[model samples]
Target: MDQHAEATGRTPDDERLVCARCGATADGPRPTWTFSMEDGRRRYFCDSCSREHLRAIEGRLDSSWW
Candidate 1:
């Protein structure tokens, strides 16, 4: 297993959640924010990106709309 997997106790595939904007993995040091889409798909965002796009997220706008 890779170092990241070892550190997070999850394999790369098991840590599938990634920031929809920046593509940062959920296993990174920064926290991740998750939102459930209307269609029931879960979207994740890194802490930095989450803070940067807080308004749009709270407005219930999709990232594609930004």
Candidate 2:
């Protein structure tokens, strides 16, 4: 996906949400994949949920073990 797409006020397929931390497709709104935090904070996670899931990762060790 294009970085400018989000800045241009464009949404994803089927109301998909992109993570603010990482630019990965988040869970769909329908069926409500969103999880609530203990502090009353609502957030979402995506394919980029963990640092170990990166593909062409840089600025780290040769984490091919993941």
Candidate 3:
């Protein structure tokens, strides 16, 4: 998925969210995904990516720093 696509804050026409870290796709607006606001844009991460980077997330580190 294109990184710029996430910044646009427009959900895909199909309403799926793609992970910023891994390009994984999921039916969005779901509770299982990890959502973050960075650089004033909404970013979503799939469950696997979120679990792998749980500590970095809790530390409030920028995803770019991870």
Candidate 4:
């Protein structure tokens, strides 16, 4: 990876992630972020997406993922 790529740590794929719950996005992803299934789907979550699977996320809804 280029130094700039290593420094800022963003890639084209980072923008491809859509939240599993709100159908939106989470925070920026790591360059090597891989896909994982939590609720038995071929999808992923931004930080806010945890609302669907994690009670803590819903309990802490006041917290901003942004």
lDDT by residue (1-66, candidate 1, tens digit) is 454533333356665555656766654434456453534545556778788988988898877776
Preferred candidate (lDDT higher): 1 or 3: 3
Model 1 ranges off by over 4 Å? 1-12, 28-32
CA shift at 48, candidate 2, in angstroms? 2.6
Give the backbone clash total of model 3.
0
Residue-level error in angstroms, candidate 1, position 1: 21
Tens digit of lDDT per residue, candidate 3, span 1-66?
555668743355766778888877766465778888998988888889999999999999989999
Candidate 3: segments with Cα more than 4 A from true spot: 2-4, 8-11
What would you estimate as the lDDT of candidate 1?
A: 0.60
lDDT string, candidate 2, 10-64, tens digits: 2544556654335566444433222223223333334444344444233322222
TM-score of candidate 1 versus the correct structure, residues matched by position = 0.61
Q: What lDDT does the true structure give each of the candidates?
A: 0.60, 0.39, 0.79, 0.41
- In candidate 2, which residue pairs get closer than 3 Å at backbone N, Cα or C atoms, i.e. clash? none
Best by TM-score: 3
lDDT of 3 at 49: 91
**lDDT winner among the candidates?**
3
Question: Candidate 4: where are CA atoms >4 Å away?
Answer: 1-15, 26-41, 55-66
Deviation in angstroms for 15 in model 3?
1.5
Give candidate 3's whole-model lDDT.
0.79
